[model samples]
Target chain A: MSYAALDLVMLGAAALIALVAVVFGRARVSWAAAGLALAVLLVATGVFDNLMIAVGLFHYAPHSVLGVAVGRAPLEDFAYPLATALMLPVVWEAVGRWQPADVRTVIASSRPISWVNTAYPFAAAYLLSTTNISVTFVVGTLFFLVPYNLLMYGINDVFDYESDLRNPRKGGVEGAVLPKRLHRPVILAATLSTLPGMLYLLAVGSWLSGLLLVLCVLGVLIYSTPPLRTKERPVADSITSSLHFVGPAIVGLALGDAAWTPQLLALLAAFFLWGYASHAFGAVQDVLADRAAGISSTATVWGARVTARIAIVAYALAGVAVLLSGWPGPLAAILVIPYLLVVAPHWNVTDERSPEANRGWKWFLWLNQLTGFGVTLLLIWWALGR
Target chain B: MPGVYLALLLITLGCMVILDWRYRLFFWRGPVRAAATLILGVVFLGVWDALGIGLGIFFRGDSPLLAGLTLAPEFPVEEVFFLVLLCYLTMNLYVAATRLLSRRGGVGGDGGNPS
Candidate 1:
């Protein structure tokens, strides 16, 4: 079980694959940029000792399924960057083949890993399950982790069809652009997929899970369909969509047998705020398209400058709420400091601000999950108070 | 205070509906999408609570925060309300993030030229 034995092998293999990916992945990227991105992915996925140590969130179990130390980060940890580097390219390739002409002009402009939020958590949680896992937990986890994602993406596609068709923001993984006509099928499939995840949970005595499944369906349905399409509204869209971000985690925590204390609630709330702040800031990049499309987003309504400021405030409040949740010590609070630090400079940014001006904000948005993970570590440590 | 919370939820949902009517979320094509979103929001929390209860993470509190709902361990019904409330927020976050990364005038992506 000791990862030390497999350390050399895993590293060599990972390096080789990454190298090959770079060589043939098309969309040529610089080695250093790739390396740097790789390193960040490693860190973000818990591959970096520096982060693990700084936060006391996760310890090197010394036991890894991969049979390699892999730098003492859990073997499950590596899935993050690996998944990102791999999945993004795969999707990118698929999208390109489906629309080669547009691929070069727009989609290929950016890398999927650079744009898509890391799905590592989902990967890690799903991949690390024990055979002893109860049917209820399995069902619940599946419900939270699987079907909802399909719905979220499907609905977004339905809502954004016009924009994606009109402009086709070509850069990175430029969110999948399915045709408007296809929205119904996509939504229907997504809805159908969500049921098993929930129904399975309900069958196992987790009635609350049934409720969650119901809500998941409702949320996706509402977010994608019209008359109540929350996606088009300003504050409403952002607020409603933010649900998918925190819902699973909250449920996961409770499912883990961690009591839903005020501390836990506040922690979850802080994360929600962080997610919202990131979401709000995220809209700034699309302000032009959204405004043109007449989409009412916080960035448009509050104006980019005001929205960014609000994001900053929201982020700050989230951090403070986390800190006030009776921190185990300053160290725990300090662990999250880096996340806040990363986002601090961008607080004042506006859409009018050049890309150069807002790069930090964008980076922080992607990295915010690490902040959440960092907080989770501190909270667990505090709860254990070992 | 709890009444205020309920009022807020109603108001927020109402406002979102009205706005959707005006702006057309999903181009105002399907109310079911929004319904799906809301239902999913509740399901996420309810399932989580059940699992949390099973896992020993959450407990019921005697507080009158969310009346009529059972609190598991020390958690209040209000806490559950917040979870759904939070779903609203994070989904927005994802949309927003997607916009920035996908839209123009942003880093867009890793800038495939990676020079």
Candidate 2:
């Protein structure tokens, strides 16, 4: 939301457009000439942007930028001419054309219904801690809402496309199996969209929040991609998945500058446990299909019955964890009861019968809405009382 | 106040003109087309400045170098001159780049290569 951050976003966009023109267009732009043009433009920008700043034509919010200056000008101002040097020639060359993506498919790939699951935690934590809507709060909420979800699920869908193709439960709200053609765009969209908000949040938030945000993003990526695909690892998978949700809440709190009281720690512990249990429990339904598709997860390694029991135990422990959070915090312990009940039906579910756990998972999905509503009421009551 | 800012802007504008004429770049290369492009650039950037000023992201500084002249509230007359220099400089750089590149392709005629 700072001028610097905004400028950086525009600069990135301009750079991307220019790259597309050079790479994909028939313009045949000379790299040597472009580099020379860029060098000259940057030098002129250094002089004139500084001069303009000195003469009082414009100024930036000190807190928003990196505070590195050339003479008197904020470094952010150079992005203007940098962008011009990049984009003007591109406009002349090809008008920066690219293929259109299937917008609906990409949105479907993001699991739109579950957007609130991640966003709610951040908004609640930041709003509760700060007790007012700050720029960080709004930006963070918007980020966690769409781009974060897209980044998380888009990567998963792209990587999991083959496996998901074998699963009948996919191609709907659970998560559509991304086509191979859309893979590049989905990944591109996820990354390109996430960076601005991510950078903006990093700029505005405390160092603690920045650290948390980095770890959280890494968790999302590592959960699905590469040799470090934590989703293929057993207990690590559950832990990483849990962090995906709990990380946002903690980041929101840190960004809001909330005090790290014992009660807050206890509350986070319970939220972490809830996420931990939910991921393990969700994996239970996919055990049979995942094993068939040659995927390894906690449930696939542990088998369905054991994984269900483990999840139920974790849920119960989550309820116990909340009791340590003081009064209204303890009230959230009640919200875990429904999850326990939903998973109890799947306790003795076998590998062949594991697909039946999908029924419980479906119910569990709707159950989350009720749980969110209950948590919101409790937060409001707590906020009003406080 | 003296028109020191305006004078500086004019001098810089003169330098860009000199570069253009000496290299047969920009306006010297093609008068009507370069004029159209440069004018369009200034108008575009002038609108950009207006947007920034309207949004309170831009404000005129209280410098003695600036003239005691206001084209509009918080907008000084010198800004018009400044915009001209910016547009003219960009055009010159772009045209010179094209010239340097095309000349390099052909035998000899490295006349305007700034390198």
**What docking grade does candidate 2 earn?**
incorrect
Q: Which stretches in model 2 have alpha-carbon errors above 4 Å? A: A1-78, A84-101, B1-115
- Candidate 1 lDDT over A119-210, as tens digits, reads 33322222222223453444555555545666676566667667676544532254566654445445443544454355435434345544
The superposed Cα distance between candidate 1 and the true structure at residue A110, in angstroms, equals 18
True contacts kept of 1: 0.00
lDDT of 2 by residue, A93-182 (tens): 332122324657788888999899899999999998889875567768988998899989998998998898899989877888887767
TM-score of each: 0.49, 0.67
Model 2 per-residue lDDT tens digits across residues B6-101? 888888888988888787776675464455345434543444454445445557778777887976656788888877776676656765676677
Indicate which candidate wins on TM-score. 2
Q: What is the i-RMS of every prediction?
A: 11.3, 8.4
lDDT of each: 0.48, 0.75
